[model samples]
Target: MALRHECIQRASTIGSNLKDGGPRRRWAAMLVLTSALAAPGLAFAQDDGALDIVVTAQKRSERLQEVPIAITALSADALDNAGATNFSGVVNMTPTLNSVPYVTNSDTLVLTMRGQGEADADKITKDGSVGIYVDGFHRSRAQGALFDLADVERVEVLRGPQGTLYGRNTTGGAVNIISKKPSGELGGKAQLTYGNRDYVRLLTSLDLPAWNNLSAKFSFLYSEKDGYVKNIGPSNDYGELGNLAGRVALRWDAGTGFVADYQFDKGRTRSTPPYYVNPSLVGVVPGYSDDPYQTYRPVDLPVSKTDYDNHGLTLSWDASDLVTLKSLTGYRELKAHSFTDLTVALGLPTFPYNIDQERRLKNREFTQEFQLVGHSGDGRLEYTIGLFYLDERGSNALFQNLTLPFGMGTVVTDRRVRATSESKAAFAQLTWTPPVLDDRLELTFGGRYTDDKKTAARSIVVNGFAVETDIRNRQTFNRFNPAFTANMKWTQDLTTYAKFSTGYRAGGSSEGGGDFTLTYGPEKITSYEVGLKSQWLDSHLLFNLAAYHNKIKGLQIDIPVDAFDPSIVDTQNIGSGTIQGLEVELIARPARDVSLTASYALVDTKVDTLLVPVGSAFDPAVNPGSPFAVGQNIADRFVIPFASRNTLTLSGDATFLRVGDNSFSAHADFRYQSGFYGAAGAGPAVPGREFYHAPSRETVNGRITWARALEGGSEMRVSLWGQNIFDTRNKQFIIAQGDTINGFVSQAAPYSEPATYGVELGFKF
Candidate 1:
């Protein structure tokens, strides 16, 4: 099928069809989508002997097929087998998840799920639409979402609104990371990897023997590599990485069915920013060409740094045979600094746009949660209730200077902003499997009430004068979200469900000039979802399909007043929109030693209305250069940017041979994404205006591994891996005609890591 045409037709026809046909049309569309995905060669499959995946998606241990929600769970072994080192790599294999790094920093991640999310991930004042939780504790800031993934047990990605269970900024979805717990067994493992560009890595972990009902584990990782793009200036190469992280966990099983766990983790990263290149300046710098991977700079290299620490404690008690109580507490701190050279060319002493900028963010957060889980004696009724609280303080400081000729007066802008937020929530959920229909029908109902408060202050200084100082404001928001789900089993291996849920993001104040009135209201979303999970052919194949439609209100958008000025952007609450999508996941083991996984997502987004203040920055009467006008309805012209319409992934693994105590396996994965707008929102597409459009791209990664038994009861393994094997020049961000007046600048993703091959050695006991 022509994905581009399909995407365009789907997006263009949604509003009218949805409005006319309503729910009936929506359901009919879902049926068509299901039929389209379940073509001739793709049969449904499920939990066979070797493919049983267990997940805690509903805050309880259950088989993946039995869960009614749309979720994808990947075990640690799967990640290791796929050569996935970070979340960005994992995203390529998942459906309906996109990770876009902010332009200012590579460490910050802007997460999107099902075409509903924010693009300005670097801002400390803005919250992410997708929520991230580590060991049941929320990570409020996107700055810390890209840390190391060592000592992880499994990761679960839940699509749609997770309002009732995970209520903080989860309008899009939630990502839950479960870390490896302490085991009462004496074991250890070590791994060493070496690759091109002087890349080197060492990972080690140890588990102590149990004693006095206590168990412990420790893990460490150190990785360093030279940049992939050479620099023509004094700075180091671009795309370099230097990271160190460690973790320690202890578990104590007290008497009377009580268990306590404590964990502490710390990590740090130091690297250079992504290289920017201007194709027009082909022969300007030494060794520079028209290639996007090469760059020319005359100034010293810029630095990007990140440091973080996390501590968590959890206590669980088996109050009785049918009930359990659990408490989770956590504290986290993060500090990050990033430097970028906005000028893509060697700043000639005569040029006027030689912008040198630096930004720093500091954050401290604390969270607490208590949960009670219980079930009836007959096991027909299950319930869970929880209370959550979070407190956070964050500060952002930005400095920009125009480095012009010595005689010319220098222009400088300095801004500092601080924000403090507190949130409290109480949630409960109940599930019942009635005696009717042979216990094959189930229903779930849940609700959550959240109260959020925020206080913010900003100070802006220009040149030697303070333009604004000590502007303070406070705002509060309260909301109640509800969720309902009904599941029916048509057969022993097939189950279908329908779910409805609501989610919201708290309101916030602007971080610019000292204006207390610059505030935006909260954004809300109501979602309707239908899904099918099935397994067939004796559990040899598994297929899962999900379709959803989301109605959003009061969507918040950040508008850039000037392309070159970051401090002048305005945030406002726009009107309403609709996002609909279809996702398909399939896994099959056609043979005993071969397995394959495939996934696809088709997302269609539309802006139903755009309401703006008459004299706002988006109003044409006040700003003729803007995309919107004062009185003219611009909803039809507004399209949700930064969301890809079509996404596909396919991966396969095969163990073709085994010689005595030696075995060899091969694995590979491929991903494709359709074109999408690069700018935050729909912008002026005129010839002279600056607009960005990310082009379509495809990437492939592969690895081959050989394992052998060692003298002791251990194993030794060696593997060779390559990412972006074809060296595809896929641009992640682009600014058109950046060197020309009203032009854009660009950066190939630092995480892309073009065309690299590496080998790793591992030993386990």
Candidate 2:
């Protein structure tokens, strides 16, 4: 009570001083607040007396509360309680994050943060603005981004530009997945789950005890399920899954303050994509249905398969109490193939009107990083310096065939492309804290220098005839990114910070049907942010707030080519834009056995001078007498698509019963998102293009669990979980074909899952 009272009094004094004078006086008042927070007697209030979260977002372990960056960390237990088993589940729990599906294939997933993302995610030559790292290794290709989490320790989502410390291509922040390390104890766990639609999942893990300072861990998982959508075609179901994955890790304490760890992982996934349906156009055509989730076709079922392997090694040496050295090396490979029915179950009369497509992608990458960390004897100054290098290679092949209105007409295309890239960088960061001003303030400075280069070759054939040959291109880019931060403690449990940072994304040549060698420039972003993190009532309550503004230059926009060919498109450095947003998170434990949390985000985006491609092949709105001409500016016609204006999430958990050795708990979550565009052009402004408008929606998920303690410190748990409890109508994708010279029709695909219920049993020893 006394600490609370002192905090209240200090806040009152600070508020008065802030209002007493002009800009300079206000600054002085803030400094005074910092001093009050740093007072010796009040420092103890910062301790929550509960669970503490540690993260390595800055290349060093530190308390999450003390870190100046905006981050959300979730433990393994929290994830299990939320019923999250994959990457898609993470977005459902985080308000500022969104996942967009790739229309061409099911294996690829596009991620967006704070209204910043790339639209051409399906292209093999393009890379995501947001970076994904697992066990200190980067995942470069989006095609293989979503993998099952077997033994994940924690997941941290960092908001804003993290380019300076994390290196290049992090303009929209990063996601870090840290795996549980091999412990020096003997233990293991196993679980089985059964759900609706005949869904079955199994997972097992074993940890071997230490022997001569060496320990090992192994994990495996298998899952299979039936599709939610009922197909009236030759196949009985659409959107099915059968996957298998495993991992092995070994850790050795070499003695003398030195250690080494190595890990290997492999996975195979086979699945069927969601059946496509256009409810709006269903009744307009003779053979289409109005039900969004129901489809009819006579063709065979399409299937997609992906196989991947990952290898990583890390070595560390704690030379002294004040300095450490670390090295990380990794290699990853992926091969994926997908077949899709572009007709989307359309039962058109003409054979050529229906289309079928297939895609094959192979990728491999190698990365290495070295770091040196040091701190002053007084524990006031800290610094880190590192070097990074990456080499990658990939290939993409696409095949399409169409039968024309007449039996005499046939069209086909086969395209093969191969690419190679390399990147090198050097980075350094330092934070200083002086004894003056009560040691309440810290200033940080960081920067990175990167050099990137890429080369690609392409071959194309039309109707078994060579149309384009011997096409090749090469490009190189370099950038210097910097970051600055000012952090201050305003009270025993309150801290505030201001930061400015910059990030960059490499450029590449166009590998499209229209023009294979056309090139685009790199993309960059400069971001400014201010945030506050606080805990009150003896650490029982927590609140965090962050607001940011970002300036984007050389935005890359993919534009379709001749209407005669819809499969080909070109990427262009269209224009500049701005993204601004606010995020708030709150957690409270009003009672000993109950906890509640909520998050909200507001995002706004604008592109001042966007350019659109114009031509008979490009525009469905254009006819012979159309007034529009090629190269005309269409800045006002485009909107930042796939971005919701407002997103909110509310969750709660409560312990209902407790016996001598048994306990029961209930958990629930509700999420809501405002309506936004599902694709680039929203309306009829861009002819021959598809315009999809996504309606606002809400969903609810709930879970109940019971745990019992066994002998020898072992335990057992059982849980019942259900998502979309209300059977909500939420569509995942939409495609509307406008008036086109090729007599193109409309198509759309809705989300397949609906009101799924499941049960799980697990044991740990």
Question: Highest lDDT: which candidate?
Answer: 1
Q: What is the C-alpha lDDT profile of model 1 across 485-531, one tens digit per residue?
A: 99998887899999989998887866652244578889999999999
CA deviation > 4 Å runs, candidate 1: 1-50, 279-291, 345-352, 403-409, 512-516, 620-631, 683-690, 735-751
Per-residue alpha-carbon lDDT of candidate 2 for residues 1-765, written as tens digits (9 for 90 to 100): 454334435443433332123443333323322222211001122233332457788888887668899888777776777787878777777888887556555546768888777666656677678888888798888775566777888888898887667744578878888899999799999989999989888999999999999999999999887877677776646667667999999999988889999999999877766566655445545575655455655556666888999999999999999999999999999898977765533323222255677889899989999989889999899999999898989998889876554455667989888899899999988999978768889899999998989998899999999988879888899999999999998776899999999988888866774666777778888999999988777676677899999998887765545433456666666678888998887665545555556677888887666644443334435445334456655665555767788776666666789999999988777666776665544433544334356666666777889999999999999999998776877666555453222323544655636788999999999
Model 2 residue runs over 4 Å out of place are: 1-51, 283-285, 344-352, 406-408, 562-566, 611-633, 683-690, 739-747
Error of 2 at 418 (Å): 0.7
RMSD of each: 6.9, 8.3
